[model samples]
Target: MAPYSVYVRAVRLALEEKGVAYRLDPVDVFAKDGPPASLLERQPFGRIPAFEHDGFRLYEAGAIERYVDEAFPGPALQPSAPRERARVNQLTSILDSYAYRTLVWDIYVERVSVPKQGRAPDEARIQTALPKAQLCLRAINDLMDDGPYLAGAALTLADLHAAPMFAYFTLAPEAEALLAEQPAIKAWWASMSRRPAVQATAYPA
Candidate 1:
């Protein structure tokens, strides 16, 4: 009943934390799952987490997250400083654009570049991205100065990024190895994954 795959649970937790009432319309991502007409009428990308609030439509996970936080506002997410807010948005973009999909590669591509189908993924994509993921991890480390939190001392949209990915990249045996090198990210992820709101909302698909 949740629109969430493990990938988008953070949005759900935000909704729950804010105490917003809504229904979950789970979108099956594996095999072209969407409403009969076209997902474009709902979400142009045919992606999950598209919301229909009283016939008003919206898309994009981050936009949905910010909307929910603003609309409900029980346990606020965004910080006051314009710079801090910029950092939150910036880190989210970096994660979404570069780092988010790579861990899936490390999984679906069992040998790190070859899928179960025996066909190889683009060697250039992996080579290009692994280093980028490393940089993202390092940037996360640098973000921890004010505290372990990403934007500042408080939990902000930065922590939302972790709740969604924990079950995915994490279940892999290699996840431990991946975390070993990235101490800051590991600490941030572990700390957040243990929080009461996150724990309560995590249903693991």
Candidate 2:
């Protein structure tokens, strides 16, 4: 599960959406002894959310999500139309490349993880990262339309990719304020959060 990892949450939600049964094995990447050798063998980087099914090994959240969507039989997570698929990929990329770092690393790690480890929140880091996080939210808002989901009317990989990150971001007061300015994104997030898949795979907050 990786505990609080958004990437792990994304994969777990996708699997739940597909109705795939699986077991979660939480890994502590920051353990004093380091990640287990088994995990390192499967994922060279010892990253969370690595999957192994019937001898098929996969890592990386994006690749794992796509594979789950295609490999399993259930509701399709991606659109059939080429343009819609592109839009899904585009939004997912934006979240992965921009929002993930600022929201998760700069804000969540500082405000949530640090405190949990008995350290105080890094106000300076949060202040430095808030503007960049705001920009990421604005970019997503600009890309999104009036549809109920990120890639349009139907939920797609884009929404799954974004939902977890947004969940964590909302925990940060500064990020929450920035999010309020983007009504469309806030509405979309509200819609995504209610889904059974999302609810089932929510991050442990």
Candidate 3:
């Protein structure tokens, strides 16, 4: 929703993995009229995914994902081991802080969103952001283990957090070319894409 909001997609994937049924209330923060009062009330920052579950309100994709995993009954998305949980959090942070801006705002917005809006892509911005985005991918690949998942043998919040952004990244040819060089990341994305939960929540390509 909101034209490539990976943060929202992260929360949706977590909910799907937990088998929690929820309705989506889409918001266009860029609308001429701006966000509605209800959304602003829940998310004062005027962001895309402010969730409401059984009268409990939550914002921020990471917090929403943790709540979904803990509050619902299904396979655990978080690792129980302290070290593994820490690793999951570490990857999530990297995606949010380092990768998201360059990958989504700079690359995806320039290549996909701008073109859709009938504006030409800013080639200069894409060129500048590519190396930073590549560095983010390299960092993630280095943190990854030999296991099938990002944290360990099982799916964790890290995988969910990063998948949506990767999906968006794949939408742009330039970003896709850069991703092709990351074998570990490509393998991980393949595995994550096969998950039923991921398939269900995936944004249209």
Better candidate number, 1 or 3, judged by lDDT: 3
lDDT of 2 by residue, 13-67 (tens): 8899999998888778768888888889888997788898899989999999999
Model 1 C-alpha lDDT per residue in residues 1-205, reported as the tens digit of each score:
2433544676777776677777776555545544433555676665676776667677777888888888775878888789888988987887687567766554424443355467866766655656665666677667667567877788886678656665566655556766788777788778887877777666542
Per-model TM-score versus the true fold: 0.80, 0.93, 0.93
Q: Which ten residues in a row have the lowest lDDT in candidate 3?
A: 1-10
Q: What is the lDDT of residue 24 in candidate 2?
A: 86
lDDT of each: 0.67, 0.86, 0.85
TM-score of 3: 0.93
